[model samples]
Target: MTKWLLPESLADILPAEARRIEELRRKLLDLYRVYGFELVMPPLVEYLESLLTGHGHDLSLRTNKLVDQLSGRTLGVRADMTPQVARIDAHLLNREGVTRLCYCGSVLHAKPMGLLSDRELLQIGAEIFGHAGVEADIQVIELALESVRLAGVEHARLDLNHPGVSRAIIEADPALARNAEDVADLLSTKDVTGLRAFASETPLQAGSLDALIALTQLYGGGEVLQRAREVLPQLPQVGQALADLEQLAGFLSDYEVSFDFADVRSGYGYHSGIVFAIYADGWHDTLVRGGRYDGVGTAFGRARPATGFSLDLRALAGGLAPAEPAKAVRAPWGCDPALSAALRALRAQGIIVVQVLPGQQQSLDEFVFDRELVCEQGQWKVRAIQ
Candidate 1:
């Protein structure tokens, strides 16, 4: 094999794509800053316990572990930045009021999240800590939508779900106790036949079992919320989850928002409350996914309410590549003071100025250089290269 051959799903990002991803990253961070979210950079690796704390078994499996050469202790590469952010909010900064923290970096997962995704992803998102209200979830969702829009992604549909609805039913009933995981899987995939067969022998209440099966079919807009009310028991936990989804749907009136009662993945793992995913045209998987996972900081000490979402910067860029880098103005190396001064001024004004080495033959395609700097009328000026 050639030395340049790389591992599967792990390839170098060439200059063209790298530039777009970097620009999108800057725009998103700027958006976060304007909304009062402070930036935090967690390390790429940490002890297995610290990295996996509070996050569920799924994330733990995704994490890659290695023994430290110095201490002989096992260290794990982070598969998600959320847990690290939670640690910072809980222990390091343990402040009084609400804390808005955002992060961007690469996390190494043992496997690709999906068929097209890479094992190494540039995850970027903002988290809200110390606020348990639906307002926190709403703020995060709005920002997630805005981030996608800014990246030039279109036709995105937001699917909202509350894991609590199905969870509340399972917790409230004792007969369906042992088969919770299996039943949850069935509902998550909306396998109506499997759900019916699984619930038939179980000693669950007839009405409740019906609602559970109905949940598999419950989807679409606000009407699903009303439909959930009719079939599912109005337990406090379940009712609260419904109300939160309803409030969020109303708040985000501008988007293509819809409810997904069968989205067990959103409700599963560490998410204690509402969960959501954004779907867009041409993407095989969810463009972005997040939810309310309160008490994520319990392992650190104080259990603060936290909510945020993250996306792969590379994936977003591939889906929304901006127009070709605007025709650049290339220059040849020279000792002339005026030529050097003009180059500096153009750069300071944010122009893409590519300078070439003296006596070196530079190809126009190399830098997409469509313009050139030359002496015209005894003055250094930029002109279109024919």
Candidate 2:
């Protein structure tokens, strides 16, 4: 075995890809800033209790645990940063009115979440706390769509599903309590054959049974919402969730919005409210998965209405090539004031200026240098390499 080799499903990010990831990070964070989202960088690790506060079971399972040497208490490498932000909002900031927070960092998972091998991921996201309105949900949804568009996936489709939709369905039929696991599996996968058998065994009326079965096929554009309202049983929970979905669709009217009613309990990390995922054209994996996770902050101190979205930066960066490498202006090493001033000036202009070391013989291939700073006729100037 190679001594320097990384563990399975883990590998080093090479220069080119690393540069792309960094560039995208800056661009997205800049956009988040523009949208009134203040960036907050949480630590890469935290105590297991604080990090896994509420609705973080999936997160807990994925987290890599270790014992803290000093405290002898178990610590965990975060598999998600959302809980940390929740703690910040609920306990640390403790501010009133809506709060907007954003974060970007690496998360480690015990198992692979791979596109190529996803033992680790660079997660970047934004969240809105203290607003419970569907309007807030719409804003974050639009923000998510714009984010992926800014990431260069302009044609991605935004698939919308409210975990509440499935919740409503279950609540409407209490008898389903016993068959909950089976129904959840069938609905989530849209397994028609299995659902038919399960629905027949239930004591639901022919009308209700038909509606339940129809939901599995009720996935498409705006019309699905209308059909859902007409076909699905009108339990109050189902009605309110449908209305929320309707409003969400209206706000996102310009984009290609989709509804998946059968994706019961659709969400991420114990998301109790609305949930959404983004799929780019020609990309098999989801580009983003996020939505409301209200009350997750209760475990900290305050339970505020909250919503947000997060995406893996590396996955998206892989699809789009990094910007053209910055052209480098190489300078010969010197103690002369003219050379130092010129180097400082170029750097100030956001130019890449590399100083060649004393007697360090190298080819252009050794480092990227397209132009050079030279002394021509005893005057310092920038010149192209011949």
Candidate 3:
């Protein structure tokens, strides 16, 4: 018999781990529910046309393509969920001023084999449609931070950056956009020497190059915002982006929060405005990242304002510390029928009621119960139980 082995980057989640992860996800999703973000479940596979409409060519290339036997046309395993949600908002939810959506599902992509990164990644996220204002941005960021806090990270930092910073530099010299692919690689690898070589050959002005180089190092807390402002001058767009982040920082100052205003970039090219990444204790990588993609819905029909964030559930599960097991309740033997009926009623109200028979009932005091009810004289006496 052949051995059963999961493919690379795919895993079989054990029961305990899966249960804990699901419990954590439920807690976070409940928090989202309180904020009015209705949950949605999008199909895992969609037509390539709908999925790849607004996605740039680079993203389309990485998509895993297939033929649909039923329709005799091309279909694609959804590489990401954001575009699919956008498509839904365009076609299904036609009437909208503002919509809040949350989703948790697996997404497939064409990744090199034997790599640790999953071809199928689990994403738990929310998106806001038809709200273009900065308020929407603030709401999304705050909700994302709340999810991180709920996941047991006592101290977490949210780093915010704007794509406009880099876009402005590229627009100043169109040639830079052509060579952006190489530049992105350099920046990702933090290859300053290679970036300098590329900038030397490109048509970008000296001041812009200096600013871009400075951005590569301007990372950290509020101080980084000052450094970025000093280095990148005469760029109104960058200044406005910095101002927006500062305003957000001021707004969230009361919470256990720290801000970073650096020229951060993301893998997705569609991000047009603010982008952010979340870091917490004991994690090797950022647990979540997302940004504003304003033009995302335009290709479908009319464009609508949008911003959202998604958490890498796998990364979150890896970083979460083990939680103590809940104390078990023991059912007492020889329970009276009337007492059992009352116990059932208590359970219906979500009360953890346990019957203590002729054996030791003293142990019940040590356990955590909101109230202790005892059946006496054909009636129940409720006593406050700590």
Candidate 4:
């Protein structure tokens, strides 16, 4: 019995949390549908080979693997929905037209048990496959910001980065690219000392190195992009990424959404361009993260430009208002046919009807405030509590 205790990181989301999450998921998915994204729900369990191949190294390792009981084959619980969606696009939705997909489900991964970051986390996200150009990227960002607003998340900050900028710098200097992980870590820490030392040893372009260092300080609403534009003027690819970002911002302007340019943090290395993470006030982790992965589609032999974003449903639920708890009701212990008939009528109306016994707490004061009922006047009249 002691060995059967549940793990630490895993938790059961009670009614309130579950209900709140359901509402948010519905709202977000509805928004996705309005924007032309068709909903796609991939199987929760898939062969390890199929699931692992499409994902980045970092994410692949986090997947929880197990042997299937039915077939004695290696299987994995999805770590994230994006890759599963990618595989679906490659294998099933191979049509030339764009395929937009929305998903909401629990993803299982390895983690300390019984914790908040347990093996299971709920995710809600959208993926746009086969669409190309900066316009697609802009649509993803705009939709993300709009969803954040719909969730009632004020003070949400959208941070944008171009994985391509880093890629470009890498192309100009393969040595630096090989050490990209080191550079990414140092930049995230704003380690000026380490950056200067690394730059001195690497044969990276002096101008690009300088811009990279200055980018660490570039954060805030749109102005950060302006600053980045001025700093890396000589780098055409970097400039184009910035311009694309500006276009994305412009589309979001109608919604009065703001963003910050986060050139320093290069997250999700596989992200080819326009990587983004959204942070709401009082939240410690990103509420959503995604980007354009043009190369991902091509990796499957289908060349297409695509972009999408996914929301961390658990995080969003924590930040949103608590769901109103289900009202508790008690069944009456009366033998009167008239009272019983009245109770049945109330129940049919979706009302929680409770009957009080001889000694049990029957007064309206005993139950939750939201719990109310219609009273029968013992074959005289019917009344409802105020």
lDDT per residue for candidate 3 within 23-118, as digits (tens), equals: 877988899899999898999888898888766665576688999999988988877788888877877787568989898888876763224466
Query: Model 2, stretches more than 4 Å misplaced?
Result: 114-117, 172-186, 193-213, 264-269, 358-367
The model with the greatest TM-score is 1
Give the candidate order by descending TM-score.
1, 2, 4, 3
Query: In candidate 3, residue 86 scores what lDDT?
Result: 82
Local accuracy by lDDT, each model = 0.86, 0.81, 0.73, 0.71
Which scores higher on lDDT, 1 or 2? 1
lDDT of 4: 0.71
State the displacement of the C-alpha of residue 141, model 2, in Å, after optimal TM-score superposition.
1.6
Clashes of each: 0, 0, 0, 13
- What's the lDDT of the predicted structure labeled candidate 1? 0.86
Better of 3 and 4 by lDDT: 3
TM-score of 2: 0.88
Question: Which regions in candidate 3 have their CA more than 4 angstroms from the true location?
Answer: 112-116, 200-204, 255-265, 323-386
C-alpha RMSD values across all candidates = 2.4, 3.0, 5.8, 4.1
Model 3 clash tally, residue pairs: 0
Candidate numbers, best lDDT first, in rank order:
1, 2, 3, 4
lDDT of 1 at 67: 99
Roughly what TM-score does model 1 have, to 2 decimal places? 0.91
lDDT (C-alpha) at residue 70 in model 4:
95
Candidate 4 regions with alpha-carbon error over 4 angstroms: 1-5, 69-73, 112-119, 189-209, 255-268, 299-301, 326-386
User: In model 4, which range of ten residues has the least summed lDDT?
Assistant: 259-268
